[model samples]
Target: MRTIQPIPFRLLLSAVLLAPCALPAQPRGPVGSVRGTVYDSLTRKPIVDAVIEVQATAQITYSDAQGRFTLDSVPLGVQQLTFSSATLDSLGLYGFAREVDVTSDTRGVLLTTPSFGTMYGRLCATAGSPSRDSAIVFGTVYDAASRTPLSKAQVSLRWLQSSEGGKELSNPERTTATGDDGVYGICGLPADVALTTTAQHDAIVSGAFNTVVGPSRMLRRDFYISRELGQAADVRTNATPSSGSGIVRGTVRYERGKALPGALVSLIAGNRSTETDAEGQFRLTGVPLGTQELNVQQIGRGGVSRAIDVTARDDGTHDFVLRGTTVLATMNVRGKVGADQAGFLRRKQDGMVRVVEREEILKRSDIGSALKRLPGLRVAQKLGGTVIEATRPMCVGQVPIVIDGALIPNPRNTTTFSVPQALSGTTAIPRATTTPAPSRAAQSSVVSAANNARVDQLMVNDVLAIEFHPGPASVPMEYWPGPPPQCGLLLIWTVASNWDK
Candidate 1:
């Protein structure tokens, strides 16, 4: 009683605070957690490595091998999620990219497996020609000086682009890099078009103290199909479509003979949808019969998805056992050029010429931009004229230009096929020449000559690739002298635009 009368305000505060502690503690978080398995509708099983991305915040989680996934700390709110796999994960006409939503009444979500598009064929240097075995071109990438493989090296394939010239132009297009094994291969590429690869390495290696690193190099090679790469017979035996309502059946098992229970599998129609199952089995009925893709999801491990074909049938059975997947190596082509590598070659409206890959080519596509991306290339005027053109250092390096197996007279001449149009603010006035120009000239002389002539039927898509040969230093002794006894650059361009008809 000694201080009670004097502590009216302080005592009131203590009593108020004590009343709240006296009440029970509030519950932590909501009680329930959403859970479910993701599977392919076509192949009945769980989908591993399928990303479950939250739509609200864009936060993401991945499914496990058992096709099971958990989303912890999912606050009570309107939530949406999606499933997506890598581009190369399947062989359907399309790939998987699906979404789902969850709310107060929704506690779980089941994701259906999606299909993937395919790009299936055999590797070769020519059609109907003897198989090169290892000589078969798989993919291109820049490798280390000691041949050690890197990842994500710049690579290209030839495709079409729009140019001011109103002619089909060929330009190197970008593609994936090598795996850890210094190899890269992909499908779902443009069909019926021949593709070649060019790889470049951009690296710095010190030979001695206080000395600069060795100059990096670029490597490119052209290859084509020999009618035998994948003949009708091969397709028939290896790939068969399902029959009866277009449904297909398949099972996933281990190389050791164990069924991958709960493994997510899918049948990739050209459109990229699928069916999956709880067991390691699948039945995709009513699926289109076109060459379909069969992909199995892999969790944790990074590599190519297992692929198979779905033929046109009423119903059929196909089995798959995936081997070890491959990881691509990286490359560095920081300081180099390639055959047909252009420097934005174009004509100015005032009769002045300007080489312009630095601006014109890059605007169209990233691959075309690479023509002038390298540091080794220098824009040079042919001594007496200001017509801008690209030239490599005499001892530094030079790129070879080839069209359909035969080499083009000059790298600048080859650019016509890739960069068919003129840069913005420039124009080309065609000059009529009475006689056909020489198809092949001395490589050395062609690099030094200049003519405002364009090749007939220059189309980007038709030319397969812009192959880069690192001068004599990179070529083996066997390919020296004049043109090798065999075709070096295989041309896949159509002689006529309507040739297919």
Candidate 2:
């Protein structure tokens, strides 16, 4: 509107060209939000007062008492979130590091912080004294079938020790390769601690050992690796298959015809053991073909044994009849089933319980898979991961999931939409009847499921045992101190001992 614009053509052109740069900048685009909860993998409990931070960003928040956290204004795209709490770290638990995609608003992000347990053992030659201390744990890995020492095998030791203040401390976890002599060892371990030892070789099944270290005691532990049937067959294509391996299937029952679950069945020579299922059934694979002695023992029951001639690839059934009598004075079953108050067998007897021990859990990759095999339980895949649901029709409230004596919050549906129901009448008018409000039972179920932890986050190898109760009536009194689940309960114990399995 001013006459200055017409002062000169050069000035006018320059002003027009510089208009954009001189103007104020436009506001940035809207940012997204991230919200979730952190849980203990072993205990399945929410971690309160935990700090959650997004990497490379200023966004941070601490979890509330419910273990819930929200990070607002998080830049959209993939972001790595970390969770930490001093209380958890003091108990030998580490923080969770997870990468999440945040294209928009996000929810139901579950992170699990795993705790550490100890295992200790010594490695030895087939006919030699405990290998030297340096080589005690690191011994030549061998193929169980071929009995040939395997070189370049990997050995690992993982454990957590206690500090002077009675706080748990985690080790850096040691791993090493087998030497030319097939010997290996892990150094710098705390004395008198429990640890988990594993040995892995090419094409061979890995071996896992659980034991505790005694003061200055050299505990000899050996690895006998075996390939699966298909793998072993392929490796021996040019040679005859070994005749020393086969499978054994059997059942354990009381003389009164009642099935005895949790019976420990072991092959005396093979050192392989397994527990019976709910139906008192047991299957032991890879038993050496020959005259083998089978020992079967159960808590509060007398031990029994039988001699059997196992044939290569044989599949047959052998049943044991255990008589209920006074605990055998010299049975020595206490060694297998520990006297600890938290022992799997002891807790199982407290209620109608089904247990999955450490050995069975290690055979699977994740706890979900191991749980899927249980009877009367439905393991389904949801948006996040596998979840367990009670298959019994009469169940009501959400099934409670407990780990290491900690109750995990259940997942929940946020919406309140209700489906229309059909009503029959001989009238011309169409009724506009609103849906009925949810019953108190239904409301409780929603709340329970909403607060439960995600079960898929739990690792199978880290679990010591699992207990499943099909209904509230079967849940143990100890697990019912709070609001009891109307449907059922699932309890998981992860603070493992050397006696587990």
Top model number, TM-score: 2
TM-score of each: 0.21, 0.31
Instruction: Estimate, for each residue in 1-501, the C-alpha lDDT of model 1 and write its tens digit.
Output: 000111121222223221111222323455234577777643355667777655444457888888777776554544445566542132111223334343334545776642211101122111223211211123323221223444544334433333576433434343544445444443223333233232333421100000011111111231111111122112113233322224557776666766655444443222232333545576655554323234454332111132232333343576666443333234454544332221111111111111232244335343333333322233233432222222321111123332222323333332222232322111222232233333444433553432212222233333323223222212211112222111111111122211222
Q: Provide the global lDDT of candidate 1 against the true structure.
A: 0.33
RMSD of each: 25.4, 31.1
lDDT of 2 by residue, 173-250 (tens): 566666555655444444455455556676554423334544333333445555542232232133333334678898
Model 2 segments beyond 4 Å from truth? Answer: 1-138, 162-171, 229-244, 247-501
- Enumerate clash totals for all models, in the order shown: 76, 23
Q: With candidate 2 superimposed using the best TM-score fit, by how many Å does residue 303's alpha carbon deviate from the native?
A: 13
- Each model's lDDT comes to 0.33, 0.53
